[model samples]
Target: MRINSLPLRVRLTLLMAMILSIACFSLMAALIYTARIVYVAPQLVPKVSTSEEMGREPLPVTIPSVPPIPSAPPIPSVPPVLIEQQINFASTGFLCVILIIASGSVLTYRVAGGALKPVTDLSKEIEEIDENNLYRQVQVPPSKDEVSRLSISFNRMIRKLEKSFTAHKHFTANAAHELKTPIAAMLARIEVVQLGGPPSLEEYKEALQDTQCNAERLNILVHDLLRMNADLNVAACVTFSAKELFQSILSELAAEVQSKDIDIEVHLEDIPVYGERNLLHRAFSNILHNAIKYNKPNGSIQITGTRHPDTTRITIADTGIGIPEDQTDKIFEPFYCVDKSRSRELGGNGLGLSITKAVIDKHSGSIQVQSAMGMGTTFEVQLPNASTVY
Candidate 1:
């Protein structure tokens, strides 16, 4: 098998062994070569020979014969024993290197495996988790190492996933429930009209109108759902006058406002904000429609807009039946209404505020509502000013 394809522990062991072997072999070769160069016998110098030994004329002085000094013994050849010893040393070195590699590779494999044990365990723990067990968390190592940090981060990711999954499930359930109600109502009305035998034209008209109303409710609910999930095109954003946006919504709700005899006041400054105009229009329209739908006769509605250095703020206050304190926080939840019967009576599917909040969030803005039961309600919206939109 390819070296890289080996298990991590094996790969690490092999790499370490290879490095050690290279170093040992290099040192051994250098020592062996140096010994061969330096272990030779010392070279001898030739001694001067007498005239008789040279077979030439006698020396001028004719000095008495003296025992010829023996020439230094011919340079001794390297001993066979020494040669054998050198061979033995080289063999021993080679054997030692082989032994070291064997032992070191084993040790390295063990060490590598120990180092990766945490990762192995973490993988097993993660494998045990599934959608039903999303709440489960992997055991975090106490040591502040990468493994510990990884476990912590994984647990955090799991939490976020769990939260998202729960929200999705909740949204789906609510959507189903809301859709089922209108469909059942329509079916019930139709079934009644059919089972009542030959019905009069008035009865037929009444049943048809009821079915149409239910269908309208269904259409509105579906529209809100689609809008909430719609992708906003940031490239399509343009600077628009908030005052004009509110004015247009007010004009659309003029009949409702007049029928309720709700005195309306507009103190809007010409504040320019940047966002999708149609979406913003729908968001404010929902808010204004609620104000008109829930207001008491002769009640007053106040709309105001102001420009800030970085943001534009708009406030809509209406003398309507205010939300209960406990239910205020839940008003933006899909299909949630403080007064379900009243909301249904006013042709509301309880998604207006949810949609409004979604739109504002997409525009990088904030919205807040303050209300006291039976007193009034106020919605404040803040959007990035045109200068800050980019």
Candidate 2:
């Protein structure tokens, strides 16, 4: 295969292996040459005497010339040229082995790289996906392998992300639509009060009250939206008694309860929870206020808390017009109103439940609602005991 087609990892591996093989081959050749020069040559050469002796040899001294000893069979006649040839052959063999290893390594790396390229591409493609773009899809080759499984999983994840993004977009659009009408009306009312002729004291008071009420509602709605975004960094580890917090919230809402002729019952168990006291109070107040606001005249609202071995459960049941089954799940959504007209009359921006839900979630607790149309509703909250470290 072409070098450029090989993946980086495989190419690097092959390159390293080739370098190592060449190094080993060079080392072996040097060792062989050194052995021949230092050890073999010394043994093969005939040694001469260094001690002083008679300067000239006697020529043809034939009397009593014993046959000269054969001098250890002439050191077995190993030709210098033949030894050089053997060394060359051995070096060539070593070179051939190195070449074979290098070639094999390169070929293996190329094959491995070709096999894994799809997986590497898939990883990079998946990494590029983010919240803003959930529609990009990976193309898997037609093969029954792990890559195919990965492709299937990636597709599923994309689908889920797409659904979540679509839902968020719809929620944002709906919230905008819901808030715009009230805001516009409030602005128009203010414009009329200003541009028109000066009004009587009572009329001025009423206009001011209307403007103030709308502004407050708008503020509450904005707060709820912020809370629903789940971007708050509120620390929530302060120790506070749940009972005392609930009592304070009830005291604050006394006037509202009295005005609506709703009887409030509080059952507080002595339970200390770790949370932000003000946030917890706000959550409870929202639930209690909603119950009173939506209840029938002279209805009863019951608040109760119980501490178990590992959890604290709080229940708020109101004799109010209950939520519809289909709409129950969405009641905690920001800007969601069960009865839009009635909500306006009640001076609500339809954000109380949303804020309440957010606060509860921040405490790592769960809130559940059980309601039937015209049969009133009950909200159950369970907070895990913080005394025990999990």
Candidate 3:
């Protein structure tokens, strides 16, 4: 049988059994060898006397003593009693060695199984967990041991799973509602036209314009959602200076900046950042767009950049409608809006910052906001310098 296919406990038990059995058998064999070396009698040869020193008389005498009478079965090479003793010793030694090997294997098997019992229980617990019962926590081992630590970790992981699952469910519902709202309006407008004999030329044009606007809003929302949820692992193929990257985004929003008559000041330092151009563009675009979108007309905006030891920092300070302290943390979550009515009125889908944060995180950077209501806001973004990235 292939050991690979065996259960962990069985494999462990067998491994321990094999190791103990080998050791026991080796020890028994060594004892037997030592007994033979130290306890067995050694044979000694008879010594011969020198003939020159004995110089004896040549008188012949024939004396056939008792030896001629019986050559009897040459007395057993080893005494019968000794042979019996040796046989008993050998038999007893073999029996003891066999018993020791058997008992040692059994004991090791049991000990190994006991040591792995906690792991086995953990496995069983994990196996029973599934989507339907993600809230069911694994039973933590009572002892403050490795097993308990593992159980605790598993519990934390499932808790996160539950939270994510809950969030996903919430997102799904909100997304459906958000999508449905615009479509329903557009459909209602068209149905009115259809029932009213297509209306006058001007009325038809008005309806088409409204429909087109809603369609565009829907398009932007769908695009933003796709981007926020995309597996967009962009490679750092090009390195761009921080100033130019920010300028490019600002240029894209120039029309809005013009419309708001917002004053922009640039104090950019020439610091190189390593990142995917498109991703950084999108991220900076969002930040600046937010700055532009929420700012009071003719508000002041400042863009600044600096070089730090490990990172390049870009700060965007805007005299826009500041976010409340409590809502700042939630701003980056998908579909979260501090002012739901205002967000809807402004056509904000609350996905831009979510996508921006994801992009920053992907580049191992960070973005943070400091703001107080009615006082304006500042956004700080830090990304690794070209030399330090990777």
**lDDT of every predicted structure (CA atoms):** 0.88, 0.80, 0.83
Q: Using TM-score as the measure, which candidate wins?
A: 3
Q: Encode model 3's per-residue lDDT on 1-390: one tens digit a residue.
A: 899999877787778777766786787778767765666544222345765557965557688665566554532255577567667877887788778767877787788789889998899988998778879998898999999999999899989988898889978888888899889999999999889874899989989999998899899889888777666455544677878887888888899999999999988877777788888899889888889989999998999888888898889999988998988998998888888898888878878898999889888899999998888999999998767764
Error of 3 at 354 (Å): 1.3
Please state every model's RMSD to the true fold in angstroms: 8.0, 9.1, 7.2
After the best TM-score superposition of candidate 3, give how far the Cα of residue 89 lies from its true spot, in angstroms.
Answer: 3.3
What is the descending lDDT order? 1, 3, 2
Q: What's the lDDT for candidate 2?
A: 0.80
Model 1 segments beyond 4 Å from truth?
1-5, 18-98, 130-134, 256-270, 290-330, 339-342, 364-390
State residue 120's C-alpha deviation in candidate 2, in Å. 6.0
Q: In model 2, which range of ten residues has the least summed lDDT?
A: 228-237
Going through the candidates in the order shown, the clash numbers are 0, 0, 0
What value of lDDT does candidate 3 attain over all alpha carbons? 0.83
lDDT of 1 at 110: 92
* Candidate 1 residue 49 C-alpha distance from true site, Å: 19
Q: Which is the winner by TM-score between candidate 1 and candidate 2?
A: 1
Per-residue error (Å), model 2, residue 259: 5.8
The CA lDDT at 18 in model 3 is 77
Q: For residues 325-360, what per-residue lDDT tens digits would candidate 2 score against the true structure?
A: 999998887768999999978877777888899988
The candidate scoring highest on lDDT is 1
